[model samples]
Target: MARSVRWVTGAKTQWTIHGEQLVDENRHIRLSTADVELPDGTRFTQYVARMPRCAMTLVFNDQQQVLLMYRHRFIIDQWVWELPGGYVDGVEDIAAAAAREVEEETGWRPRSMEHLATFQPAIGSVDQPQQVYLARGADRTDTAPDVNEAEKLDWFTLPEAATMIERGEIVGAATVVAVYRALTLAP
Candidate 1:
């Protein structure tokens, strides 16, 4: 069976605002008009952002557990268990950012890592696309954490993590998604 594809219409930048110090908002498709002619002549206009993000799932083999951080989110006003990750700096590769974040948050380094998945939590409003990576054979060398970002660090087994998810102990969107994926991919 042949599948049909849609084409984009002409679009223009309407306005932009600073979402954060590093990220910005762009209302580019607001002025879109003149539908583009596709091979099948079907057209569509979609608002999108080109934002970038980085995330990691840290798995420690010796303890047979995953490294998680219990951090207080100011926006939510609660501490939640989550995997360590953050936004990638300018021109920083995703793998480097993942390793840096894991070390920054948990004071541990992974011996190896591999790309897992990419997701966009909110396509309608937020333009951030989170890059998820899996870190294997991690080793703990220190207890220091990025004090400004997280509070306590802990390790959880797969079953314990499932329980935490069910009990709502793990709340961050990216963390939850990544953890779930890791559990499924676990050997």
Candidate 2:
């Protein structure tokens, strides 16, 4: 049996700059608007922002506990528990980025890492795709927290993680999704 796939076309009609921000007083992002046409004879406009892809990791220590970060997101105005991760640098490989992120955020280095999965949190609007990796047999090292990103770091058992999710403590989409997947596939 064969399944048919539908393809849609969009044409850019107009683009305008809305605003810009200096992320670090040097790097900046310019938000813009664009009018597009749909293949189904529909016309619409969308606001888009250029961003970079990010890499994250689900790291398990010798005790089988997963590393989690307690961080505050200004945009969301709340603190949540999340996996350690960050944007991919142009000069860095994906696996390297993942390992770097884990080390920087959690102070743990994995003896072995395996690719787990990749997902777009919001494909319709956001351009960022998050790649997740599974790191096993991690050893705790000295940690230097990136104060701008995370406030606390800790390890949680699977049951504790589930409770956090149920109680709305761990709310990041990628963190929650990755944790559940890792728990299911854990040996």
Candidate 3:
């Protein structure tokens, strides 16, 4: 047997999609435009971006330090702190994909993994869902990250990580959410 939970919000608004077009298609992403009617009877065509769901790993070591990557993102033109994560490969399980990304990016594998949360990283424009995992007892391995990946790896205590986020050092939404959850959520 299963239990169902109903959620409610004070306000109600509905949107109806008349039609949608796949304006652009590629191996990694698909861009589309949808003609939609709002609850207020206003209608318009809006562009949307669709991408494969990805996973993020918040690997914490025995010392309670979380693993992170420091890299320069050209789009942002700044070096930012991020977690080990990437897009899910073809037909791969979300947890498995997170483990793979962690190993490939940080040369470490988690001895135990737990699903933390999932969300649409860019809910307003992109339909890219992200699943986050809390990885414990991570051990270093011989595997190396891709050459195009992070410039360096480091671990930070929970407080340090939280401070980094507060100071805007952690710019990525996925990383921010995972780190915040890691700090606040119970085991």
Candidate lDDT scores, in order, read 0.73, 0.79, 0.90
Report RMSD for candidate 1: 8.0
Q: Model 1, 1-187: lDDT tens per residue?
A: 9999965569543333222232344332122222233444455543344555756665556767888888888898877888888878877888889888888877888778898778888775556778778877787767677888678888888789878988988887777787778778847
* TM-score attained by model 2: 0.80
Tens-digit lDDT track for model 3 on 80-176? 9999899999899989999999998888999888999999977877999999999987988888876678999999988898899888889999899
lDDT of 2 at 52: 75
Model 2: clashing residue pairs? none
Error of 2 at 139 (Å): 1.8
- Tens-digit lDDT track for model 2 on 1-187? 9999965568443433344343232122335555656554576667655567788898888888888999888889989999999888886888789988888877788777788888888776566778889888787678766777688888898779988999999888788888888878838
**Pairs of residues at least 3 apart in sequence or in different chains that clash in candidate 1:** none
Tell me each candidate's TM-score. Answer: 0.71, 0.80, 0.90
Worst 10 residues of 2 by lDDT: 20-29
Q: After superposition, how far is residue 168 of candidate 1 from its true place, in Å?
A: 1.1
Q: Which ten residues in a row have the lowest lDDT in candidate 3?
A: 178-187
